[model samples]
Target: MDLAPFKHVLLLPRVRPLALLMFFARMPPAATGVILTLHVAVTLDKGYGAAGLVGAAGTIGMGLGAPLMGKLIDERGLRAMLAVSVTASATFWLSAPLMGYWVLLVCSFLVGLLGVPMMSIGRQVITALVPESRRRVALSVDSISVELSFMGGPALGVFVATKFSTSAALLFIGVSTLVAGLLLYWANPPMIHEDEVVDGPRPKIIEWMRGRIVGVLVVCVGATVCLAGMEVSAIASLEHIGKQSWLGVVFFAMCAASIAGGLVYGGVKKAPSVLVLLVVMAAFEIPVGLGDGSVLWLCLLIIPMNITCAPLIAASGEHISRLAPPTARGLAIGLQGSAFTVGNAIGAPIAGVAIDHGGAPAGFAIVGVIGLLVAGVAWLLARQRKPVATQTTMAS
Candidate 1:
């Protein structure tokens, strides 16, 4: 395997720190939902269903707020957005533990609406800092950091909640959020490339927002639909087989496969199209339902599908950066964040219904089929893309 691609990207100024920043930045948000669930279910003595409602409120807020925050970044700049978001986050998390259920639910939505725009910032910074040629590798590294954070963050949140207290967990998240925000503010990474021109007129939405960009965004949603559904189906499968204890091991294997896949994809000279990767990922997911009810078999079946995960995400980021005008990249990235949020909101419930009616196998098949259908829609939309017009700034 070629190590040169990885080395080249990391050696670029600012790329390594940005990657590390994103990893640490992602951890607190990754654990926020799980921490909230534990707080409601365990501390408040509420049922899991009630906890889920609060979580859903937060998700809805994120989906709506991401684009607004992105627009803010576009208008005012990164530091301005960060200051407001950091303040909102600190206030929310600090006061969250003391609130009653209704107050927490309402405040959760408000807090989510103002949550730090880390994910969007990470991608935008990559596009600005890394040249078009190195984006695949850079984005692959970013995706790996994301996977690592998700892998450790929720587990740590659970451990703290279980061992210490949910209040302690919430406080921990609060402190971490403040620190991450301050670091990001101080670092103050560029949102546009030094070679790129931004003082010119911003393009109207119609000029830059084309069918191809929409298609890429659609694929983003579809990819997450499959991923989130797969996770739910996996848990349901383990529970059905009375092997719930193996979940941590199974998830670790899946994440490791994703990281490995990302590393390989990044090192390659060329990467596949986002649509193509998503199709392959969805194809792999369908067979996971057919595993022979053993940990080894499940892990084996899961690996191939997950291998496409990071590559697909990296491809999506690469495509968005290429297609979107630099001036509008923040908003575009924000929409991408919203797409993933919408997918997460949709995926698990669909899988849950399938699991309830037809068991774990049906959950896998249903989500897999849906993912394929969505990918097909994205392909059709992409095919409708018009020829590019001449411009001062060339989009990828």
Candidate 2:
């Protein structure tokens, strides 16, 4: 609806390139996700269960690796993280196509373990470059760009795999990772460190988690959980209704709504709180789950649920930027990634079991109820937040 948010952030000299770099960097994860499952199930003749385990290994690795990478970035800066991640990632991805099932399991874990820190790095750069007042816009731009990769990468992965070859898809992921690595290396976005405290005890990372930061992190996790659950349920529903082929179109529509919502969020002078947005997101999806099993009904119901997606993420990003101490921003941002990854890991499988027991509606109900519960707690935590950090920062 509005172009100012896009114009404001993109016009920045430093931000423009980093945004482009992130677009490329984000592709590998999405591409590999589809390719890995397809490779294991179709090409290697392994079943879905085995494919799920292989995928889980990578997800678990990422959940653990993101925060660790963030801590290192806080100490060493972005360049060092980029160097290690790019090399490790390139090696792991290139080798992925060659490994047998057992070896592939090991490599997936290692691949996730050494996953490129593009997301953490990109968020840290945004935090450092944008002032607090303008952070909402910056965050929205970042969220929107991420959604583009989120939507396109998997489609591309499936296309290459189906149309050509699985090996070609794997090769594409590896080559793309290599290119993304080089782009990041050249961008080398500078980190801004806080002024040193001469005599006072330095702030601890745990200290930053004292208030709204905790809420931000939890709300983000919950939002992602909903996404993962919704995805699993949608696919399962399609299969049940015998229209599974429409899966790509369904997901693509949702992604488009998210991008549109993100654009509006950035344009608005003030956006709703993360908890409120989550409530809306959770509430809307229930109807989708209860839909009369048809593609048309599913698409109609998903509109409201998809609308809130990127706006909620943008709010969480802005909240963490405000909540964390300037010095530990990278760690804070990284932890956010870790939280989302954990949600990503748990949501689908849990929903899968639910889908099996009572069909897609059951999974949808489970995830929606979970969202409502988490949003309630997030609201409580947010309300309890002391203005201590803002006051202290202002006084200084």
Candidate 3:
């Protein structure tokens, strides 16, 4: 099949709103690490452990808050939810450093909980606004924006923190978030309108959680765990080796690879089945784990490993959009994003502990094993359902 047809699918006519939403959604990831780093520096007398605990609190808060925000968006319109979330996030972030440790923890939690749903909302909006055939590519682009945010956010955070202070950095993050949200509100992107009256009350969470859709969510959780573990391990390893500065280079390589992979995947007319893609992506870790190579070799391995991240996310988004009821799409994406946030929260600590005691290779090996297991889960999920005739049809 000529893949040229698929290339056009990646280009949406009204992409401005999506781009704007993504810019706002990415601010937290960009700023959170720097905030934490600076918070630790300022509070070292309080204990490094406290900083870690606060960071964990923020992540947990995000994980818990996302689903609730999703439900609200389902009931209310995007504007209301965005306004509430953005305002809350901005207020918490701006005021965070002024508070005591316990209060900071609370504010961080509130910020994270309120801060995260914007990205999920953006994803839901894209699914609703974009045509089915082009949704995968669009989602891939969205994922790329997320990766870019991570790549760029920390650097920005560092600069802000260095130039001013941790409090200033936090303020900057808060302002950026508010600006993004306001821009999105003014833009008023098109969304699927809900009816005033429902046939019945909404389905129970358990009812919504049933079937292949849950499987996709599980895969997302697993993939996020692996990614987080890998990221934590890589950072720790580089630090241990006294090559901490190379961490940025390594991430840049990985992100560059992901961008190329996303473009390639978006262009493929006959992309592999989700199961196959999962397997192929998981296999990329083997090279990473087997080599004890230099930074360049590690960078090389990152490209293939990074390439799969976006496509895997795009696949999950496709599945969630296809399986969820129209009214519940927001909640569905929220649940998926929540799973990812939880996985990230869990992964970093686990990997950090593993690297501290067992060493870097052990940490990477652990992540690799997790990826393999997730691949197996993907295969089982694929087997449970009949394969669709085409990837595009599966997405629809």
Q: Return the top candidate by lDDT.
A: 1
lDDT of 2 by residue, 60-128 (tens): 888888887787777787778877888888887787778899999988887787778666776777766
lDDT of 3 by residue, 123-222 (tens): 7776766677677777777777777777778888888888888778877887887787787778767555232123566665565455466567767777
List clash counts for every candidate, in order: 0, 0, 1
Which residues of candidate 2, in runs, are more than 4 Å off? 193-202, 385-396
Q: How many residue-pair clashes does candidate 2 contain?
A: 0
Q: How many backbone clashes does candidate 3 have?
A: 1
Error of 2 at 61 (Å): 0.3
- What's model 3's TM-score? 0.89
C-alpha lDDT of residue 233 in model 1: 93
| Model 2: lowest-lDDT 10 consecutive positions | 387-396
Which candidate number maximizes TM-score? 1
Residue-level lDDT tens digits of model 1 in 1-396: 576988888899988888898899889998999999989998999989999999999999898888888888888899999989999998899888899999999989998898887788888887788887788888988898889998989998899988999999999999999999999999999988887766878887688777788888899999999999999999999998899999998899889999999999998776677887888888888889887377778888999989999988888888877777778788889999999999888899999999999888888888889999999999888877442522311122
